[model samples]
Target: MHTTEHHWITTPITADILRGALDLEHTEHGVLPHRLPARARAQCVDGQLAMAESQPSGVRLVFRTRATAVELDTLPTKRVYVGVPPRPEGVYDLLVDGRPAGRAGVTGGNTLTIDLTTGTAEHQAGPVGTLRFTDLPDSVKNVEIWLPHNETTELVALRTDAPIEPAPDGDRKVWLHHGSSISHGSDAASPTATWPALAATLGGVALINLGLGGSALLDPFTARAMRDTPADLISLKVGINLVNADLMRLRAFTPAVHGFLDTIREGHPAAPLLVVSPILCPIHEDTPGPGAFDLGALSTGKLRFRATGDPAERAAGKLTLNVIQEELARIVEQRADEDPNLHYLDGRELYGQADSAELPLPDQLHPDAATHRRIGERFAELAFTADGPFTDRSA
Candidate 1:
């Protein structure tokens, strides 16, 4: 806490200062970052969509300030699944001069409890919480506060001992990426450790992450949002959500993929557009889904997912992880004839059977922290290096 003699300067949270978010909504308390814009959000009225969009997965506060201490006030909506172990508290990562400085978390926020069996959700109101970072070197430096990736956060106010300005843009390419919850940081230990975030850091790119949990269903509105957003590079990780949600058949999925890419092409016709298939999820690798929580694991205070659909259903056009990978590869090949910039990277290339053998997904779905680091490192080497699909055209 700063002494009274230290006059706090409050800075308004504006678009120019926010990074890795596509849209910002004015809330009663303050501004809420949305991975999908208002127009896109309006197109979907489901609870999953609501929760996913509101949670600012890769959103962060970026600025340059001379403050020795900083305080951010926020209202967060935390999710609670009924009959399961309580969720971990969200972490706020602070980076000074582009180096990891410290990590913190807030307490006492609104809780949304969802009953999986009944498909009912109840909201319990809570008070706004403050995250304070102090005892820093008193000099002008770039500062970044990566918001909690899993919680829906309303940025109420930011106060610093010194005046703050937007961080100057670097010579990095702007990489816009979209995917499901796994890409949304699922089990990644911290905000900055998410695969996409880690990849961006290694690739030296500015990330606009549009990864939405349980909601990457090839929605046209999401496609439209990506179509309109500006980016130097783009990538889409598809399939897992489609399978887990049991949202579509392969017959419908192929056309949806084409349509989504079609929309993105409307804006960036020649940008490197890499399409990634799902990572290895043994449960969904051969079996179809509607993924269900593992009751046995749940009873033991663990959260694990199991494919509920029969493996035989794949013959009926029901999509499985393996099926999606094949379809996606074919789809990308067909499109690549006309769109030379289009490329495909099988998710297995990032995390396959062998990698799984060594670093198993704790939940039999999303990767753990170490796997995230591995994927990010591999992605950088595969996609961002020379002769990679995402190699710079100008070079």
Candidate 2:
């Protein structure tokens, strides 16, 4: 039951160095570049700049997508989540679907609340933050938000009840995705240029980017999050972080993945869910991880030191990429019967090779901007089209 709503048309606004408070957020918003680069000096270092000269709260909306694309449905009920950057006290109004959703601000901590049931205003309170609404009308093709007061607020994540609509006719199938920093586009050159963003363009499906930089360690919170959300297609890019971050050992990895899949199945028992492992990394491929740096990488002064992963870490069943892949094969094979819709995408196929031409990870990890695009393209080819995203989903 949705009524005619005012569709907010988005205007191209270049990110700016404002005259207000600056709040670093999980997602990039109100900035020149859409993503925060890994090295801090990359091209898309939008959020790296200092806050506005003025003390006013500089705001940015941290929605999951740079722009939210919703298809015209009989009844569009979408719930978008924008991560709240740690903020101070202030009452900010929120206008969604061209109505007064209400003002939500932080009195102390970092969260704000807006009640759309109250008033009707064309403009909402500034201090960009996360908010949710329901019963979006089919005619409301686009949703434009206004943060009049703050220079910018981080729009972290976004979601919808209906699938993302394709452009022109706006009737494409919904595409849902989940992954780690690579998927989150942590150090990409630009927001729209992230691997997921690029893949979305190639596939023409609505995107649900669940890439939480350092937080994609296959936790219950994440699995629960996925289960709660709806998607026509789903993909989970796991591994690496577990090894890189040294989050767990081989003994724990298999069971943890089983638990993760089990959790998602609670909600999406029938939808296709793809499980992807990490790509090739010289430091952690067949070799084991929880790697240590080379002692020689350290400067005598000790002010700056670089370390390489210990070669010995890959002895047998340590934390290497090969070991994880084997475990994944086992997990997927065992679960395939219970969950016929389940699938597995080997990360190596995305970037592995007999030649093994390694891309130098500036920090001994994570891909550079160019590599990110390459990964995205490879992913799009394998995941999207064919029978589905990751057409080559097998052992």
Candidate 3:
């Protein structure tokens, strides 16, 4: 009989741990970058740079992995996704140990297909299957994977020849996240280029992005989802969406925040959790939000600045970014006495007045690719690199 040692496995994704791991760097060079024979509505006038699949290229992906054995009968599995969501049209090709396994993924269906050539196991996305080639020759060394781009979003994780190391024994770890569209990479650049994707690249962790563009209002379902998932590293980037979506009022906010945290604790008893407030938004910088501006054409009248009164209403409705930041400090300080892993990271510190002054975001709603890069660098420095978050690789 075969034996399974269940060697420890490390998450290959180094990008965002929020919604999906946005693999921008790969998408730019892969299938989607090919700019398909089609055109996608651009997110910005300049175009979706960091996350958009503008120019597509045929690039091979390399997955450096070590395999493990199974006790018996239970086949192993590995799953690769287009990581970058809000994906446009694109094509992905898969290869194993240099063998052309085949390709799949459609703009309409959001699915994937694989041809083993050997026809071992068939996988698709819409039908959303996994392509598996088993009973190997046993001489495999490196796994080479590839995904071409489309005209929409970028690639997430390219298909792989090597599967994720067979799950280890004991407990499995997960990465949990919650945030706004920014965390969802709303209008940044490419699929893989979002800030979350960039940060994940450096973090080398599992991900579960809960970045609802207009929806992150600390909903119960969201809290339940977090509470249900088994996580190793958990983070919640609140405020931005609550402010942008104009979703809640402070009267209902404080309890919502506490309840959100409480819900997650149900699943992750002592997991490392981080709470981040919004980054600086000059439109709402000190002005408080539900920020808004009259984009209507100047009525050929005076050049006076128009006020929508929405920003004020939004601000009054919920906590200001600074307010959340301060409250987060208090929450963590109070919780720190009981939970050593609970941490608070100010979004401003990630992208605040200083960063805005240094390199501003494009639409005031989203950070530019350069800014994303900067944020990635800082996140690595503050959270991941050296002896930081990776400390609990045991997860």
Candidate 4:
């Protein structure tokens, strides 16, 4: 709170230091983060795509500063679902020297109201918000200000009591990941607490998370984006979005998965590409989708999802979790003969039958904060270890 000897300096948010965001556009107020590139975004006009890419899940501001006090001015679009419990304020997690230092939330920002019944949303303007942290160690340290995962944040200003510079890349491999809302930090506590974020921390890698909510269908544009993004490791968590969206049948699904991987291979032929299946979601395990809101739970002020399609639809080539898993495993196994770097990870290994009994999905879809932590830990152990798919091969 004390500004008396604070030699405040505004740092330029260049692409070199910003993590998790695919693109950044300067605005009248500041810079806006976009999880998808402009070209890719231009190819889609859906509302879900707009919201998901702008939500900034896994995005963070990284730099090295000797300043002990820091203040960041931002304009966050906080979403509120009417008739249900209000979501918590977006959290800003601060890390110094790769360790947790503090956590805070912005007080004022834009608000987005959603009507579940009609699937419509309204935006309301609000004043800019600020996040401040003080009492940091006086010595030079690597500082990471992780933005809100659930809120769309516009970076207005970043001020520190001393000069700052881009943090040195400590030889960390970049991990490019693509998945659905669950991977986008849906119900997680904060941006850094997302499973991918946590896994990045444990694996000692930088992350470029392309986890778009409701938009993870096997689009060519998304595959192209992944192909062009520089990465030492790549992963795709496929299935849930496809099933919940009812986007394709078994016939289209097979070729689509192959095309998606083929596109990525065009860019990096030898990069470790791990294909992950969906985690357990009882609603869509045997049943098909398009997933619908559980009206019964909504009436009591809760948000829950249910699969609306009949289980018998599988005979007609309709996709379900079980079907997708089998196909993904087969696809990966068949590809691994020629593409030795390719691997398959059954998502159930992260959160499956036994674990679900104790830590069930609160919304009947996405995992909670505790599950996010569990998944992150499991992923780190399984994928980054010496025998895992992402093990370093440079001997």
Best by lDDT: 4
Task: Identify the superior model by lDDT, candidate 1 or candidate 2.
Answer: 1
Each model's backbone clash number:
0, 34, 48, 0
Q: What TM-score does each of the candidates earn? A: 0.97, 0.56, 0.57, 0.98
Q: Write the per-residue lDDT of candidate 4 for residues 269-366, one digit (tens) a residue.
A: 99999999999999999999999999999999999999999999999999999999999999999999999999999999999999899999998999
Model 2 stretches with alpha carbons more than 4 Å out: 1-152, 155-170, 291-317, 354-359, 389-395
Q: How well does candidate 1 score on lDDT at residue 91? A: 90
> Model 2: per-residue lDDT, tens digit, 1-395?
96645344333332222111122223333332212222322322222122211111212232222233322111111111122122223334333432444444331122224222232213233333444444445443434232322222333333454433222314555555656666766446544456776686677655556564544577665677577765667889887777766767777777889898888888888777888888776667755545453333322211111223554765544576777888887889898987888888888777676414656565555676787788888878877767764443452
Ranking by TM-score: 4, 1, 3, 2
Every model's Cα RMSD, please? 1.6, 15.2, 14.0, 1.2
Q: Candidate 3 local accuracy as lDDT? A: 0.50
For model 2 the local lDDT of residue 294 reads: 34
Badly placed stretches (over 4 Å) of model 4 are 1-5
> Model 4 misses residue 24 by how many Å?
0.6
lDDT (0 to 1) per candidate: 0.91, 0.51, 0.50, 0.93
Clash pairs for candidate 1: none
Pick by TM-score: 1 or 2, better one: 1
Q: Assess candidate 1 and give its lDDT.
A: 0.91
